[model samples]
Target: MSEWLQLPFVQNALLGGLLAGILCGIMGTYVVANRIAYLAGGIAHAAYGGVGLALFFGLSPLLGVLGFTLAGALIMGWLYLRERHRADTAIGVLWAFGMAVGVLFTDLTPGYNVDLMSYLFGSILAISRGSLAAMAALIVAIGLFVICFYRDLAAVSYDDEFARARGIPVTALQLLLIVSVALSVVVLIRVVGLILVIALLTIAPYMAEKRCRSLASMMVMSSLLNCLFAVVGLGLSIRFNVTSGPAIICVASLAYFAFMGWLALRRRA
Candidate 1:
């Protein structure tokens, strides 16, 4: 373990985990408060198209993924605002379309040989310093946004009507939330892959919510849980020569089940 920690790549993975943990905690909370798990999934799978585009254009895949997902998020937010009745349907359409675009574009790329598994399950050790910087920037941006609009976001998340009565720009805030989710999704994809990203964005907060009395407390607890899972998972991956992303996510799932079992046993007692 000590020897593994000495490796540069291992250090990068640890840093990535720390950054990812923070982003996941914040975005996960937003997803829960807004009740947008599926919407988050939409944004994540949609970012695959951006990955394909990036590969085709010789650009940074992460940047491409963020751009494409953000665009999709904005469009989805607009449609939802315009017709709340059809928000789910609109998200479904975009979700399927974004996934198809990514797959189709990847297939069309000439002589492009990329490992699909890395994007699906994550290769945290493969994360570069540049990616870490991007993740750090995202965390800072999200922190700033949260600090600036905590109250309005709280009201909007819990009750849009009340938020509006209080003069909150519900539409703009929703847009911002969607964009934030997109950014988080981009960073998370590198940690847990698109297939399992939503779980990371959701499970920690869900667990923390069971014990926390306030949203602020929930966020703090979730961040701590996320960090623990990331560190333990990364350590296990290093010890066993397994993949870091899945290891991290599996740790989270274990924590989820453990908490549930404990709760059930306590209820029985």
Candidate 2:
């Protein structure tokens, strides 16, 4: 353990894990409360478009991903509000379209993008200092958003009809929620990858929902749980010489299932 922490890569992975855990906990609460788990896949996969664009244009992948995801999130949120198309259907389309765009752009790039897998499956050990800073900034922004709009968000999340009656900007807040979800997805992309992002985003929050009475409490508990998962998963990966993202998700899955089994037994007893 001591030896593992001594390595720079391990240290970076830990830092990335901690930061991702915090953001996921915060955002996951909203995702579950809003019943928008599907949105995670849409935003994450759509982000791949940005990554491919960045690689092709020789720009920052982070910027490209963020821009593309925000656009996708906005579209998803808007589509959810309309009467004609179902939100899930829209999400499905965007999910496939985004990834397809990424692949197309990557193909058009000067050379085959060898590092595409890193974004797809994550590269936590390779987290850069700039990535850490970006994560910190996003976390801060989310914290502030929650602090400033707690009442409105809570009202909208739990009861949009009631919130609108109370003069809350329900539509705007809904859009904001999706955009924030996009940011949260970005925070985890480097650590967990697009494919596994939903697991990281939802697992801790799902488990915490059973134990917590309030959304705020759920966020706190979920954050702690996510941190534990990240730490334990990272340890397992280091020992087994495997990929960290899937390892972390595996640990989380075990814990989630264990908790469910315990709940079932408790109810029976």
Candidate 3:
């Protein structure tokens, strides 16, 4: 294990996982607080269109996904804001549409044999230094955004009506949150894939929410929990020769269930 950690690819994978964990931890707090998991999922799945776009255009897949997901996020954000009650139906439609677009473009990319599973399930061990740098930049951007607007974000997350009454721009903040989630989803696609990205984003934050008293504390604890899950999952994957993305999510899911079970037993007792 120690020797394996020294390998450049392994090191990149570890760093990538940690960066992804932190990014997810912060944005995920708002995601769970805002009850926008479905919205995030839509953005994530929609990102596949970007993958196919990149492939078809012979551009970097990450760049393609980044641009495509942001566009999808804006569209979904508007739909959500415009029709809050019926947003789910629209989001679901866009979600499938985005995926279908990806598949169509991928097929149209003549003579290109794309590894579809990598985008859908992740390819963490194959992550490069460039991807790591991109992930780090996103973390810095998101960190600054959170620091500057923590109070307003907290107000909006918990109660938009009160936030609006207090003169906070609830609608704008909600849109920004959606955009941030899209960025986070783009970075995490390599860590946990589009399908499992929501699990990594929501599970740790969801667990932390139950134990923390404040949004700030929840973010802090959630980051730590996500980091732990990433590290443990990566280690287990290496040890058992399993797929890293699924391994990480499995660990997180187990922890979530275990924590809930403990709470249930305590309540009964």
Q: Give the per-residue lDDT digits (tens) of candidate 1, residues 1-269.
A: 88888899899989888888878888888788677887888788778878888888888886788789889988887887687777888888898898787777788889997777887888888888888998889889999999999888888888999999988899899899889888888877866687657767899988987898767787888888888998999999888988877788889999899999999999999
- The candidate that wins on lDDT is 3
Rank order (by TM-score, best first): 3, 2, 1
| Model 3 lDDT at residue 250 | 91
lDDT of each: 0.84, 0.86, 0.90
> Candidate 1 or 3, higher lDDT?
3
Highest TM-score scorer = 3
Error of 3 at 87 (Å): 0.6
lDDT of 3 by residue, 1-269 (tens): 99998899899999988888888889889998888989999999999999899999999987899999999999999999888889999999989999999999999999987777887879899988878998899999999999999999999999899999999999999999999999888887866698667887799999999989998898888889998998999999999999998899899999999999999999999
Evaluated at residue 178, the lDDT of candidate 3 is: 95
Residue 231's lDDT within candidate 2 is: 93
Q: Between candidates 2 and 3, which one is better according to TM-score? A: 3
lDDT of 3 at 267: 96
Q: In angstroms, how far off is 173's CA in candidate 1?
A: 0.9
TM-score of each: 0.93, 0.95, 0.96
Winner of 1 and 3 under TM-score: 3
Candidate 2, 235: how far from true, in Å? 0.5
